[model samples]
Target: MAASAYSDHPELCVKDNFKQSNFKRRIQVQCDLLKEDQCSAFTAISHSDKAIILSFRGSEEDEVTMEVVDAITVLPVTEFSGKAKVNQYFYDAFNDLWNAGIKNDFLSLKNANPGYELWVTGHSLGAAMASLAATTLVTTKIFPADKIKLVTFGQPRVGDKTYAELIDSIIPYAYRVIHKNDLVANIPPQFLYGYHHHKSEVWYNNDMTKGQPYLECDEDESKKCSDSVIDLSIPDHSMYYNVTGSFASNGCKGWNVFTQ
Candidate 1:
């Protein structure tokens, strides 16, 4: 597909006027895993369309932060226990993002384009937060039903079937792209509650460490999974977004879409 196929909507990629103090505040947060050596390297840059991109480097890897055009929310990931608290924390984090966008200064940017859509996305833990944030916005009617969407890479289950059902009932378009052999998504925290959820497509691959290029599943691999599952093994967990674009571009609308 041509690069022009993807609409460069203003709200999808907006920039933020970040100050030096924001970095200080990020470091001050005691519980945040983003803490590092002497200097706190976290930075939030707003895209022209209004979405905020937060980038930071940890001891071994780097992390990217996301904020939608109309919603400049942060992920409140304080704990990891499998409880309603995890759900509520995600809810609060998303609410904060919504509040950020509508705040006095943030409102000016949002009102500049009333037709803009709010989106949240991430990779790894960030992807998990994106899923939670999207669910919260839809459940609370924070944004239009179909207008909100989520694009996550290697996301895990947020809650039980009830939570998934709540998310499915409200959000019309949510896509979770899983790379082949990505063990993170397989953890299945929500499945423990008897809430079985599957992906729209499982982009698999032979080696994820190299480039993680995406590939369609062979006939044999697809049969190993039940009809309930779409085993994507192309990208092999790491390189889900290949040169051909991510799984989202291939039309995997997720379990929420087809079920409804």
Candidate 2:
């Protein structure tokens, strides 16, 4: 679904993704892509399996970072009762997208699919949005934390230690998938900026190919995993699961178009 999020027409790309997968049953792509100048996401559902997916699209470096460079300060989030502080830009971006439209579409999807599991994912900047989205869903009582599964790739630090722990405690199944030395994963220079990632870092020790070795570090920003890499490379950030493209079905290693 993360790959599907990149398409101009997600409804068609997602169906193409499902068709290419191993599942015996297909998912329902109920809407077009959720896109804006700064962020984008796509939603799909499998009624038979009682599951829903919200996949956010990665952004170009220049476009996403511009929002951060100007609003680099960290601020206490109102939703967390001023307890957890986060990058003001990340916070604003999430709220802007949520209040603008994603919230209503999400709520409607939930109401229509009772007992369905929520699976959220993204890459790069989209990873930031996905992190906030999952946390918001739980904080707003939209879904019990346990019912949501969040797995992001090349995820940067979303907040400070307190905020990371809050996300950790709430989203137990969260996993930040980092390719070996993904430059984006080391953003804000860690402690220098007081930003930290959440727990369970899934690090692919080598090139992330079908049979490559990987590790799951239970500590947030674990030094024992991807954090251990001394040399960081930006190119590594764009090739999750061994696919190579900017941020679409092409990145997932295959492409096809179908009329909806």
Candidate 3:
């Protein structure tokens, strides 16, 4: 179920060229840097299934900017009623976009599509934003916690232990999927930064074989999980959604796979 959410991202990126299939409403979201910093995402509604998907795009600009944002340590979740703390940069970025009408837009969509199940997803930086968005949705009472589902690929640690506990308890179905050797998954070093991920992880091994299966790691934060192990490489981060072939050897990038 979670993996399928990721598969929808490629189509969501094709804004102008998008063809409305199962999705009845497609809202393109790109927060101008002057207005709300660099935040971009899209929300689509599937009336047939009563599902609302909020997908965020990965970094498409300067890598230096992304590194700077990722380094913004920790801050309290004071923006809402939660006692938990989150990555300052992620929260600030998400807050800026939310305040710029994304929140109201989402709420309006929710009201318009009553009874629709909300699913949030993204990759890389987008995944971090998605996590913050999910947290905000629950914290603000815009929607009941259980009514939302979050599934992110190559997601970094968004908050501290308390924040992890809070999200895990509230969101109900949060799945963080990591591919083997994907360095982005081991970001914001836990020991050095005191960051932690939410409970429940789905790990796919490096070796892709006919019978190879994804492992479900221990849900407890103390477990550390497979993602806790250090493996800093960007190629793995881009290899998801059944994409095969060596990215480096083929002179191709992950984004190329999606764009092509």
Candidate 4:
């Protein structure tokens, strides 16, 4: 798929201001799932189209907590327990949200929308949750594996080789969008922890100007892909929609990019 096709959806998913009081003013349906110290997510029907979007929010004040969650390594998908495993923390967080009613709400919205498509997305931690949710939905038969469109920004590796193969085969339209030097995309380091990413990565160059190259690397764990490298700085991870003149202008604070 073209970069334009995948890029547009994530832009919409990450652009929301997330003001709870007036969330409906921004998106059609706002279903908030926040458990202090657990997980955070919201499901909304698009204001302009018939798409049901489930977006996850990254660590706000608990960076250390999220880091710990990332270190939990792989755990099997509850349904396919012995056969497939995913990042334990991401799956746990997503499981919390699913149990809290995202599944029912998602089905209700799908039935109401009739012909609308289902889109699952997020950035950083949200991206991880989105990946978990997308994969789980497929395994549970809540939604057809082929119908879910997943586009994540700054998403970390969410599973091992088996989990990656399962999702890559089931979700053909899954796109992992990584921007230049986005450090979050590189963790929990594949070499150190045996984590792996799904196929079809859309990598954007550091340049913000038009005509900058966006390459789609087909290898599942190639060094040519962004996740294979490590750069501690998080500026590029949060620069999907907003492009700063230079890294100095934003730096690690780029996490604020999506909200504005």
Candidate 5:
């Protein structure tokens, strides 16, 4: 579903793409696309898992999203309790997409599905939005925080220490999958801007080739994971598992490798 968001037309990626993917029979896209300020995502219903998968498209080749990717400044997570703060740009973009149409679409889907769980995933910029969505969805009573399952690749910091703590306390199944030396995962500088990552990090220390080992960090922001890398690379941000190249280049191929 994440790959589908990159297509020139929603049907090409959302419908046709899913037909060719591994989860074709198990999951189906209900909403082709949701967009506001280049923040794109889609809603998918999984019959086997009885869940709703909200997959956000990663960064675009535009300046507007690039600015938000900077991860500077902060905004309050109004739905979440306590003094939780997040990246102003990310929060706005998430809210923009959510308010534009995701709310109604999601609510309708949830009502139809009834007891379905919420699952969110993304990469790069989309990863940040996924985090915010997970938190907001919980605080708004859309889903019990514990029922929302989140697994994002190359996720960057979405909020401050308190917010990170909220995620740790709220969601037990959340996991941030950071490929070895993913530069995007290091942005917003923890020391400089005071942004912090949530708990449960799954760090791939190698090239993420088949048979390669990965570490489930013992710490929320474990230095022993990708943070220990001697060098970081931007290209690393684009590939996860067997999925490789830019979003357009993938053509929605190789998703089975990661989805499994």
Candidate 6:
């Protein structure tokens, strides 16, 4: 296809360009379980030539041990829940670590590579961190403000309506992925808040509407909501490898696949 021909059809051109650009990006992730004083934590950093994803798992238990348990305690939980105090602490922790990681990467890449894009993703608490990191990246101009994307899976409500809107405004590609019946999504942050203003969709399991956590209100908000959000219930709350697509796959195993 000629360049002029593509320019005439801008949407097609952009899609084609993104598809081609996906292969040029590099993928880098760091997973670590650390112990400090009386707490145990897990942190994972997944980056690509185009984007970056950082996740931190909370303590497995109240004891000081290095173990990554898949229980609710070990995952990231958003703020604005009934337990506001605990939620804020985790949110601040994720922000501090994420900012450090992003600053390191952004500074290192600033001189040699000036225009790389960015995206952040995570399952639960990780998802909330990813969203906040994405916003922070744009707000600080560490990455291209318009190029930042957020894909959160089964993320609890991070904040109220204003916070969600602030997040959405910083990046154009913010997307929150919800499963069909996953109860974690509805825990606290009700859907009416402004912070949940970004694009959202439901990921189905076997059937379209059978067994997954579903977000019913995003359609009325996002002008371009996807048909599905990719059901994360199949393998429990971990949808790390299922998201597939140039923008999503990032070479992950299952939940990373992009589903239309």
Best lDDT among the predictions, by candidate number: 2
lDDT of 4 by residue, 1-260 (tens): 11111231323323342222111111111222333454455556664555667766554434634454545544434335565666666677776767677677777777777776677877776688788888877877777876688988878888777778888888878888888877777777777456788877888766444556777887687678675455655667656645421222222233344233
Residues 193-218 of candidate 5: C-alpha lDDT, one tens digit per residue: 56888878898877787788998985
List TM-scores for all candidates, in order: 0.49, 0.83, 0.75, 0.73, 0.82, 0.52
Best by TM-score: 2
Error of 3 at 120 (Å): 0.5
Candidate 2, residues 1-260: lDDT per residue as tens digits?
66666666566555544543222122222111323345666667756557777777766655545534433444434447665767765666666666666677777778877888988888876788799999888887879898899999888777788789899888988999999988778875665557788898989978876667789899987889987878988779877776643445333335422222
Arranged by lDDT with the best first, the candidates are 2, 5, 3, 4, 6, 1
A best-first ranking of the candidates according to their TM-score comes to 2, 5, 3, 4, 6, 1
> lDDT by residue for model 1 over 97-181, one digit each (tens)?
3444322332343345465555555554445556665655455554566766566665555445545555556666666565656
Misplaced by over 4 Å in model 3 are 1-37, 61-69, 72-79, 207-211, 218-225, 244-260
lDDT of 6 by residue, 1-260 (tens): 11111022222322333333211112222323343411111221223344332332322123212221222234334443232222343356555564445456444544444465544555555565566666666655657767665666656566555566566555667666654544444434333222233445444432233233433444323423322332324233333233212222122223212332
**Cα shift from native, residue 247, model 6 (Å):** 21
For model 3, how does the per-residue alpha-carbon lDDT over 1-260 read when each residue is reduced to its tens digit? 22222332433333212333243332334433433435555556655556777766554435524544544434435444557767776676666666666676677778887888888887766688888899878876888887788888878777778778888778888888787767666767677456787867887775433456777874844344565556556676766756522222222233333345
Candidates 3 and 4 compared by TM-score, better number: 3
Q: What C-alpha lDDT values do all the predictions have? A: 0.38, 0.70, 0.63, 0.62, 0.69, 0.41
Could you tell me the lDDT of residue 196 within candidate 5? 85
Which ranges in model 6 have alpha carbons more than 4 Å from their true place? 1-87, 99-102, 191-197, 205-236, 239-260
- Clash count of each predicted structure: 26, 0, 0, 0, 0, 32
- For model 2, the superposed segments whose C-alpha errors exceed 4 Å read 19-37, 61-79, 245-260
Q: Is candidate 4 or candidate 5 better by TM-score?
A: 5
For candidate 5, the per-residue lDDT at 218 reads 52
